[model samples]
Target chain A: MAEPSWSNALEALADNKFVLGDQLVDVGISAPELASALAAVAMAQGELGHARHLYHWSHELQGISKEIRAESGKALSVLRHHENWIELMVSLLAVNVAARVLLERLRQLNEAMVVSKTAKMLVEMAEHITFAGEWCRRFRAETGAIPGLFQAALSRQSDAICAWLRAVDAEIGGGSDMDMANAFVREMEMVCGPVTVRHPA
Target chain B: MSTSVEYRAYAVFARSQRGGPLYQIGFVEAFSDALAKTYANLTYDEENWFELCVVPLDELRWVIEPQGVSAKGESGRGGAIVEQRAGSAG
Candidate 1:
């Protein structure tokens, strides 16, 4: 496949953010506590704001109109294919953590616009990662079934996650696919410990 | 099954700028001091604070009479005494 331009990558990132934010807003209605629900709402608003920023940046950088850019449906299908809240949380935790790492590296780019935008996004993403980590920890402590649920979610979505990483790598030329996957898994383990899942033979 | 965890209440204070007075912004509940700080930071970071801190609600000592209330005022202080309880505040 031909490598995607920086503009295309930004578009994809924006779509992913929108999808993630939308899902969070939907799931937040059922949050166990008012505090957790409010946190989810805050995170959803932040992610949506980031998406708008990226979309506007892409439009300006590539001379694409906002209307045209908005019509582009490049969101990840994996996010739409979740089975449960636990699955959604696991997938979001993994994807957002990995995206944070990639965005950090992208901030090293010499382009002033890219550096500034990436820095702003990184600060917000740090809070997202922290919130996700804390939620995962709470799930583990309260549910007692989070490890198994996470493992099942990971096994089900591994392919999509790997493909997403590959596409991001192709666009940005950062870490290898294996390296990114390992980093994501390590972060997941830190949040929820060793997840064990049985694979179909 | 969802397990219930007792979250300690923390009172948050923030200074809007350098050398400014630290005013009470809000409160948050968490299972630990670290989580309380995180919750406080996440929930009350709308402003550009010069500094922020969180202390357990139980740690604060309430002044019942503000140093110079007469015996008449003391009779009406029952409400303040009840409100000072840790559980009541939380």
Candidate 2:
């Protein structure tokens, strides 16, 4: 990709963080287990923190006090609150994986500040990915021989996830070798199950 | 967590300085080391530690007692040091 101007990409990435953070706490409140709730809250904090940093980096903030950007109109519908625990897990998995794809692309910017911040965020995201994958396996195991519960959820979110990624690729002005949407689907399928991203080659 | 793997207890350790020795701070119960390490950092977030580590409770060799021994008693850990010697004496 011709170096992502990073201006719009940062804005879009920030929006993802805002939506993901909100949905985490919202869905996490109904989490049956205390550990799950706590982990969700922690992840929410991390996402919001990333959103704040991204906004700062892109100079999207109006003033020093107005650091973090609010949720944009463009955030994906799939990122919203879900009805049940499994749905919540799937939503989180999608956002977590897609965001990592974007960040990996962002890492290509290779500037000192961008590289440092993305590196830290990537570290936290590794944990998030681990949590998402573990939850999917756990949820599937709970269904006990009933197949497709995880796949069903992934299928539901796949379209929106692909759209969000396409936007990221476009916003980044990706002329690079890596197709983010395809990369996202590959990583996502590795975590949950097969995902057919119809859009983006 | 109904379908989740059994959660394992992990002993958490951290050091705040560059050369500081890792100190055993506490423990967290988690399904894997990734979660355990995250939980340890999340739970013991008071310090700006330079490093953190989490090891499964089962991995530790029991130099003392292998049985369930409460550390809540007068004994420091395992509650077997003084009591076992007294028991053996009798």
Give the per-residue lDDT of model 1 (tens digit) for A140-183: 66656766676667655555655665666665665564555555
Off by over 4 Å in 1: A1-4, A68-71, A81-85, A143-146, A154-159, A171-177, A195-201, B58-90
DockQ (CA atoms), all models: 0.28, 0.32
Report the lDDT of model 2 for residue A67: 38
Residues A86-183 of candidate 2 have per-residue lDDT tens digits of 77778777777877887777667666766776788888878877877777766666655434666677777877777766766665563743378788
> Clashing residue pairs, candidate 2?
A1-A175, A1-A176
TM-score against native, each model: 0.76, 0.78
Sum up the clashes in candidate 1: 0
- Stretches of model 2 off by over 4 angstroms after superposition: A1-5, A60-69, A144-147, A171-178, A199-201, B1-4, B18-21, B66-90
Model 1 has an lDDT value of 0.69
Candidate 2 TM-score to native: 0.78
